[model samples]
Target: MQIPVNQKFRLLSMLGEHISMCIIGVPLMGLSLLTHGNWGFYFVLVLYLNKDFLNGRSPLKRLLNTQVQQTTDVPANEWQCFLRNTTLIIWPLEVLVVAINGRRRLGDYLANTHVANVSEDIGSWKKELAAYRVTSYTFYTLLATGLYLLLVHTLFDWLGF
Candidate 1:
């Protein structure tokens, strides 16, 4: 089945949210690793899940003014939030399945969910670009710097230089 434009918009919003999470997550992961070592992974996971659970949207999604709600219900509750966030655990596999299936992912199939265009106006390139610029400059810049520092430290430590 052909995906609707709104669904496409939702997919874009989801991608934005994931990117935003990575931007914030990687830096925190770096800090956690530098301080506590392996605990960083757990910290990142908890942070990602909790943020998503607290709001139906993440920082990126919020910037875009998009939300992820259940298709069956008007307003998704805590259980749905938990389930939705938990799905991230298998998100990679889910994406692989969706790619192979040509857009019938587990999340879409199981939840009977479809991402809708919640933004008052859809197809605003200016808005999307502005959001991207803000997210990139603020979050991604920190993530890049942190990763660079971590990489340099690891390399020097490994090389004994």
Candidate 2:
């Protein structure tokens, strides 16, 4: 089934979140190597597990004025957050699943939640700005940059350069 345009935005937002994690993670991984400490690993582990709760919003979702909500319209609880985030371990496959399921990835199906672009929830001129498609493209640009960083990290590791 063809995904709705709005759902497309949400899907892109999800992908942006994954990319953002990688962008943030590679640097922290470097720090971990430098210090010979697992601090970065633990930090990212917490973030990976509780992304939806980081300051009451997932970073990328907040940027897009979107949030994950249960089908019943309640805020997703911690358990739901953990369940959905498990799929993030295979983020690329998660994107494909979201595309095929029209925005509901396997974890979303299990968690019984959906990502919503709730501009009205922001309550400011920021809501007006989010209405523009440029904002989404900007997010996509950030995602591309994050992917580039991840690729470079992988190449350097593989080449031992």
Candidate 3:
């Protein structure tokens, strides 16, 4: 299939990188359980709250050559990186968003960012990270976490768990 959005992030590439990142959670959860009991779930939760787009490219995404950038022509900021990743808790919806719309994912809209063509760079994330709003970030992060827990509980309920 053609790479969508003029060579932004193809569906398979995006999914592959995310799935690969999830793989790392296995060991994290195992270790966290041993040391932190049920808090292990929190340890593994970072699998969704991605910091890769802020600190550095995941080796996989770099190999795939996908870059996240702001739609407003500014380099992506720290909040965007975190908020964009948090939306992966609803990854199924995001997949549908991309596969049907042939456009940015749901998280991209939440963060006001997009996966840009390979030629585009997000610029110094280190510097961008320095610019953050603590109140808003914490508030939204809690909101995202609450939504995640609600979704999980709803799914388990629907399944009679």
**Reference-based TM-score of each model:** 0.55, 0.66, 0.63
Looking at model 1, residue 87 earns an lDDT score of 60
RMSD of 3: 5.3
lDDT by residue for model 1 (55-159), tens: 344456556655445664242333344345546657777666555654334665664544333554533445644544232334533453355446655766799
Error of 1 at 11 (Å): 3.5
Question: Over the stretch 8-105, how does candidate 3's per-residue lDDT look in tens digits?
Answer: 35577668866776687777778877885645555456545654444324556566555666776444655576777777667888888888767688
Cα lDDT of model 2 by residue, 24-119, tens digit: 888998899899875675567557756874222576767676667777655565556666776665778878886776767777887897776564
lDDT of 1: 0.52
Identify the runs in model 1 with alpha carbons over 4 angstroms from their true place: 1-7, 96-105, 108-113, 119-161
C-alpha lDDT (0 to 100) for residue 15 of candidate 1: 65
Best by TM-score: 2
Top lDDT model: 2
Order the numbered candidates by lDDT, best leading: 2, 3, 1
For model 2, the local distance difference test gives 0.64
Q: What root-mean-square deviation over C-alphas does model 2 reach?
A: 11.5
**Superior by TM-score: candidate 2 or candidate 3:** 2
